[model samples]
Target: MSWLALFFLGTFTGLLAGIFGLGGGFLLVPLLSALGIPVAEAAGTSLIAVWFSAIAGSSLNWLKDKFDGGKSFQIAFLGIPAAQLGVVVSNLFPDRLLKLIFAVLLLGMIYLMNLRQQLSEQETDIKLAPSPPTPGATGRKFYWWRYASIGAVSGFMSGLFGIGGGLIMVPLQLGFLAETLESAVANSLGAMVAIAASGLIGHAWRSEVLWIPGLCLGAGSIFGAPLGSYILPRLPNGLVTTAFRLLLLILSIYMVRASWASGWV
Candidate 1:
């Protein structure tokens, strides 16, 4: 294996991980496979690297007062258990068809993201025109159950797809919880630590992980994550969120291609 290339991939993915709360699977899984690693091993190793990256990025967010620990913890509380069930579900479906479905869902997410932007725009215009609802007025009661459901759904997707679950979590946080983009990212990263840890345990138990490569990736990711976190605060929220949607769209397109390649689409 080319350790240098792996390290570089880790660095690149780690940067994205920190920026988007994405575990960077859209690159890491393919890169590792290109390097001759089996897909299962690649997923396992990438998950470990993702976990560490999330740890580093979230710690920085927490220190900067950007993380919502309470919400993050609540999300994780349900996510962990659902992940186990999701792993089970992964085995139930044909991989090619499942990936196609996931791709379609990602497209739906892109649409929802745009819809969210429209709603936020309306809110912004309203705020500009007149005395909006009092600042202290409860905007919406915090729906703990909805958050848990988000965790469960995202967790299931994570386990089934062998991913970090951040893609599912981040947009939902924005749409449902009305969190700022930065805060959603910070909270998503914090919550993913638990989800990734659960995935690692399952992968390790199955002996699917490539320990040396995973370690190398994790080492590089920690260094890269802080760089991304540093850049995150400086970027426009709308730009970053648009980039996030584009990234998901690109990944979904990749999945569609993969499905066709596998003769399933």
Candidate 2:
């Protein structure tokens, strides 16, 4: 029954991953911890599901020629090392503290999602009332340092929280790299392939992963990811963004309660 539960959870998370380029760790770690798994083990185990789902989703994007290979590669290369560092840092925190931290991250995500929705609305208005192209708009420079910073921070989050880092990467790409939502999602998934793999290695070294449960979750994600990819371009961005933000809010509340219950507050 536990295996079945994890599989279903993975399927749902995979769907979110496909659409948002998330690794699903944000949802997974908290839920797993709620289900009585240790926070560290939950975080580590979530990475296995993240890795497989990322591969599934990214492959679909690649096949459709929707991927941003160059940016993905840049993020992945730097993210690999940073992920290791995040794992080391994660081991220093206690479980209750980690739950609080994850809850805070979720609140942050809600704020970013609100910002992204506003940006999307602005873009729609611009399209409706076309303006003269701003000078140099098409010639915006690609800054390597910006990409490096995005990769490093996202990678660290992935390792520390068992998230796919898409939660960070997509917003950063939109704000800093001027990528469209779809493009940022694709690139985030591409980068996650490497980031999750690196995180899994570090977690395994510490014997933190729950292999059987993680595998069951990953197997389910394989099916869910393709479905999410198929739905992405067809859905309304505003609706999805609003719905995702709500889901994050609910999860954040749950995590906060869990942390408080841990007698640490």
Alpha carbon lDDT of each predicted model: 0.71, 0.82
- Give me the runs in candidate 1 sitting further than 4 Å from their true place: 18-21, 33-41, 105-109, 112-142, 229-253, 263-265
The lDDT of model 1 is 0.71
List where candidate 2 sits over 4 angstroms from the true fold: 16-21, 124-142, 228-242
Q: Who wins the TM-score comparison?
A: 2
Q: Write the per-residue lDDT of candidate 1 for residues 15-118, one digit (tens) a residue.
A: 87667545665557656654555445556677778788778777877788887888888788888888767666655666566657767867876776676566
What tens-digit string does per-residue lDDT give for candidate 2 at 92-203?
A: 9887888888999999988876776666566566568857233254443456667777999989988888888876788777776766777878888898999999999998
TM values, all candidates: 0.77, 0.87
Clashing pairs in 1: none
> What is residue 41's positional error in candidate 1, in angstroms?
4.1
